[model samples]
Target: MVIVDDHALLAESLELALNFEGYDARRVELPEEPPSETKLVSLITRSQPRIVLLDLDLGQHGSGVRLIAPLARAGVDVVVVTSSTDEPDWGHALHAGARTVLSKTMPLGEILGTVRRLNHGLSVLDVEDRERLIRAWMGQEQRIIEIRRRLDQLSPRESQVLEHLMGGLTVGEIAKLRVVSEATVRTQVKSVLAKLGVSSQIAAVSIAHQADWRAA
Candidate 1:
């Protein structure tokens, strides 16, 4: 396993703990200006670890969040261990392919137990985090369903774009899926965000979890 965090002390401490658990761990202290995303992509392709313990806030890079989707796309499992409690981050991390989000403020034992469970193919999520995510998911679902119910308010193309958006596809990906230009998808995304009163994609997704909008 590998740990990516700007904090040296936290990295070292986690390394010690993992070593005690019979796991090999390494730390990568990314520089102020990280190498290209390509280089980080190369590292993951080369290392191919079992799991990545990622910190959401890594100074300016925030490579941790950026890498989640790519790593997951490459079949790598990620478990986020970060201080961010932003509802959108929770949904974004999961949408980006994280298996779980373990808060840093939790007890070390709980953290260790989560890691162990994740390693063993069993999920590790505290009840509170679990419930919170459930709510976020429900909220997102509700927003999507309501929007769809009022599809007449949207142009056919906008409705199509929104379908892809709700499926967690990035704007670029949605453009390709719809065989449209990137700019069009961006426009649709902006419109969707505005119509839903969401400032970001994360909030849009968090609104998807509402039971009223859970594909009923």
Candidate 2:
């Protein structure tokens, strides 16, 4: 596993902590000194770490969130470690396909547990966080149902497209996986977005994410 943070001290501490837990951890300080994105990617790819511990607030200039899709595409799991209790951050992290979101304020044991759970293909969120997400999901699910009812929409293909969308699959990736043309996938995505009355893929996915569609 790898840990990325702007704070060198925190990275060192986490390196020791994770090593103690048998993670074979390495630490990287994502300071402004790093001049190239290619360098960071090369470092991470060379390390071939199974997971990355990222800090959302990387000293105001960088975003660990932006690394989510790239790392995930590289077959790595990102577990965000931050002190922010903001709902939007949590949603963004989840929407970006983070394996887990852990608060820095949480107990060490809880953090460890979350890490273990995520490594096992499970997600970990605080109870309160889960409740809040569920409530938001219920509202969104109602909205989706209403929209679908009104439009008499969501054919099997469209629904499949929506499922892939919710799973964070890009149009190109989905097309390749489904053995279809990118244009076809793009059209299906647009149709689903129009039917749901949502203007963006992220918003459509966010609704399904909060609704716990896959979890259920």
TM-score top scorer: 1
* Tens digit of per-residue lDDT, candidate 1, span 120-157: 88856666776677578667656666765544455667
Error of 2 at 106 (Å): 0.9
Residue 198 local lDDT, model 2: 83
**Per-residue lDDT tens digits of candidate 2, residues 84-119?**
876567666666767777888887767777777877
Q: What lDDT does each candidate get?
A: 0.73, 0.74
Model 1 has an lDDT value of 0.73
True-structure Cα RMSD, model 2? 13.6
Models, CA RMSD each: 11.5, 13.6
